[model samples]
Target: MHQAPDILSLARKAPVMFNELELLQYREQQIPGSVQYTIHRYRRQSQFEVDDMGMLVYHRVEKNSKENYLELRFCISGNTYCRQKEIECDNCRFSLSNSCEQKSPSVDVLSFLFSPTHLSQFINGGKMKSMPDEIVHFRHASSFSKTLTLCGKTRTVLEALLNHNYSGSMENIFLNAQMQMLLLYSLECMIGEKEEMAFTCKFLANESDREKIEKAREILLQHIGEPITIKELSRKVAINECYLKKGFKELYGTTVFDFYQSQRMEHARYLLYEKGLSVTEVSMMLGYSSISHFSTAFKKHTGIKPCELLLR
Candidate 1:
C-alpha cells in the first residue's frame, strides 16, 4: 500500500532555485529617475532547452555572466533565499543561481540594476551630504559589497503597488515614484547604520543594556503563539518596562509590538505558501478569529493578499 508523502516535510527540505525557466519570463521595464535603473521581473516558469540527444541531467545547468551594474534584489515574497557569487566588478564570470532547501510554491523578486556612473549621479543629485562614510569609503575602495535591511516604510511603499496593480503609462509613473522613494530610504538606512556603529564604538557603557534587550527579543520569539504584554516581558528580563519599550526601538529601529507582529506575518507567509496551509487554517494558527483580519494583516506585511499568494 502506498501512503501519501508529507508535503510539508518535503517543502522544508527542498531547494528553491532560479532555473532557466524562471529567467525566460523576464520582462524589462524602463526605470524612472536620472539614475536609469533597469527592472527585470520573472513572472512564470523557465524556458530551458532540452537536448534531444538524450543527455541525462539531474541539476539546473549553470550559466556564467559578468555584470557592469549594481543589482538590488528585493525578495518581496515566496522563498527568501538566493545563491549569489561575491561581487566582482572587473567583468569576471561567476555562478549566479539561487536555491533554498525548502518547498517554495512561487517567488516574486524585484531587481534594480545600476551602472557606476549613474550611481554617482544619483548620489550627487539626491544631496549626498547625508550618505554614510561607508559609501564614501567604497567610492574610493577597490571592491565592496553590502546587504541592507529594508525598513517598514520602505516595505510599505513596495506593498502599496498592490492597490494599483496595472500595466500602462500610469503604472510606470507610479513605479518611478516608488523607486525614488526606495532609493531615498536605502540611503537613510545607510546613514542610520553608520550612526549606530559610531554610537556602539563610543558607548561601551550601554553594552549591558543592549544584551538585556536582545534577551527580551528571544523571549518574544519563543512565545509568539501567545501574546505577552510589555510589562510581562520586561519582568522576565529584569528590565524596566519603559526602558524595555524605548530600548526595543532604539536597538531595532521598530516598536516591540510592530517587530513581533511583523515576524508573525513573515512566518505566516511561509506557512501559507511553502507549507501549503489554507487561509482559514493559517488564520486560526496565528490566533486570528476572523479570516478577514488575517488577510488584512498578511497583506500589510507582504503587500499582497493571502489568496493572491495561494493563487500564484
Candidate 2:
C-alpha cells in the first residue's frame, strides 16, 4: 500500500516526462485505511497526434514482490481528425505552429488510479465469491483490462466530477463521494444482477444492436438543446422504436425520455450556475416554449427551480 503514494506521485512529474500531454489539473485524496485515489485531467498537446494514448503503471511493492491494479480511463471530450484521407491520424504529425488547415485534436481525459487494498474493501465476505475474477484476483495478475460502456448514471457522475463548485475540505468530500458512486456503477455494469440479466431486451444481445443503442444515446446527448422523439432517434440509429425504448432502459437503467430530460436539466443547471445565464435565456436555449414550463420541468428533475439554482 505504501507504493500507492509512489505510483500517484508520478502524476506530479508527468509534465517533464510526457511531452505530448499537458497536465491541466491533478488531485489526490487518501481516506486513511479506506482508499487512496487520484483524479487527473490532461489535454493532449496539439503538436503530437496519437491514434492511441495510454498510461503505464509499474512499481515494486517489496524486495521481490510487485502488484498490479486496473485503470479506468474516460475521454471527457474532443475528436481526432486527419486532413489527408489516405494517411491515419497516428501517422500524421504536426509542427508546433500547427500550419495545417485542421489542427490536431485536443483531447481532455479524466483518469482514475485506485489502490488494490481500497478496491478489496468493496467485496464483503461471501459476496467475494460472486465477484468477477478480474476483480477478485486483481492484485496478483500483471495485466487485466475491461472496456465499460458509459451508462447514463455513470455519465452523470462523471459530469459532476468534472463540473462542481465545491472547494477545500468540502471539495475533497464531494469528490470522494462521487468516486465511490462511479465504482458502484462500474461494478453493477460489469457484474449485472440476475433479474436485470434475465429481463435484458433480447435484441440487445447482438453486438450490432448494442452498438446501435449506444449510438442512439450519443445522439440524445448531442441534441440536448433540441430533443428528438423516439421515432426520430430510432430512425437515425436504424433500430425499431419499441426495441430502442426497451433496450435503452435495459442498458442505461432509465427510459429514453427520462435520460433525455435528466441530461437537459443537468445542462440547464450548468448554464444557470456556472455560465450565469438567466432562467428565461436557458429555457429558450433548451427549446422550451415558455419560462414557466421550463421551470416546472427543471424543478421536477432537480427538486429546485432554475432561478433558485442561479441564486446558489
Candidate 3:
C-alpha cells in the first residue's frame, strides 16, 4: 500500500521563494498522501500567490513561525476551516484568517499574503490597529472567529481575480492594483465587524451564537430568488430579528438584503456563463419581477450587462 505524505512534509516542499523573487508560473502537484495544491506566484514585491487546493485536510497542525502579514482569501469553492479549530468550512465565502505556518486544506481558494507593514500603510492610512506583529498568535481570542467571514464586496473582488486565470505576469501592474483593492475591501469588512463587537456588545463569545449566525446566512442564501425580510429569516433561523440583522452584518459584512441580492446576481452569472441560460430565463429563475430590473441589477453588480458577457 502506498502511504500518503503528511501535511507538514508536503508543506515543506510547497515551493519556497527567497530574497526578491519574480516568477509568474503556475504549478500543480499532488503529494503521495493525496494532497493536491496548485500554486502561482504572481508578484515579487507583494509576494502574491494564489493557491487552489483539494480536500484531504489537516485538523490540528504542528506549531511554527508565521511572519506578520495580512492574508485575504476567497473561497471559490469547497469548504475550508474557518470558525472551529477542527477542519470545516461552515458557511463562508471569503475568509480573512491569520496566515501562519499552520495552514488548512481549503480547496478552491484565491489567497494574497503580503507584509503587514505594506498593507497597514494603505489600509486606512495606517490608522487601523490589530496589525500583525512578528510574534503573532494564530489562535482565536475573545469574540473573534478564527477566520473573519465576508460576503458581497470582498467576494466580488475575488471573483474578478479568478477571471484573470492566465499563468503569467502579462498584466502585473493592473493585477497589483486589484490586489490592493482586495486588501481595502477586506479592511472595510474587518473594521465593520470590529465596530460591532467593541461598541455594541461584550461576551459575544458563545459558540451557539456563531452557529445561529451561520444558519441565518444559509437560510438567506437559500431563499435568494424569493424576497425574504430580516424578520422572516430570523424566525426561520430561530434567532431574534435584531440579532439577526446586527449579527449577520457583523459576521458576513453585509446586510441581509444586500447579501441576498449580491448572491442572486452571482448565481445569475453562473447560469448565464456556465449553464448557458438566456438573460430572461436566468432572471425569471431567480424570481426577478422584470427583465429590465434583472439587467439593471446585473450591470450594477458586475459592471457589465448580461448581454455583454455573452459577446465576450
CA lDDT of every candidate: 0.53, 0.62, 0.51
* Candidate 1, 1-312: lDDT as tens digits: 111111211222222323322431234665544334432333333332111110000111113112234444454443222222123222222222232232222334455544444455544444335334324222321122234566898778756643344567777787767766776676676557656663432222365666577678777776656778899999998888888887888666689998788768866877877889999998888788799998998888778899998887
What would the per-residue lDDT of candidate 2 be over residues 31-106, giving only the tens digit for each residue? 5544466555555554443332223232223333335454555554444333442342334443333445543354
Runs in model 2 lying further than 4 Å from the true structure: 1-37, 40-110, 113-199
Each model's Cα RMSD: 18.9, 20.8, 18.7
* Candidate No. with top TM-score: 3
Off by over 4 Å in 1: 1-204
C-alpha TM-scores of all predictions: 0.40, 0.44, 0.45
Deviation in Å, model 3, residue 93 alpha carbon: 40
How far off is residue 77 in model 1, in Å? 18
Arranged by lDDT with the best first, the candidates are 2, 1, 3
Query: Residue 260 in model 3: shift from native, Å?
Result: 1.4
Residues 1-312 of candidate 3 have per-residue lDDT tens digits of 111122221232232222223333354542322123344433323323333221111111124313333344443432223333334333232343444333333324344545433534433433323622211222221112224455577666655654454435444544566667765665555556645665242323565676577667666656767878777878887878777778777765678877778778877877887779899899899888999999999888778899987665
How high is the lDDT of residue 262 in model 2? 75
Task: Pick out the ten consecutive residues of candidate 2 with the lowest summed lDDT.
Answer: 1-10
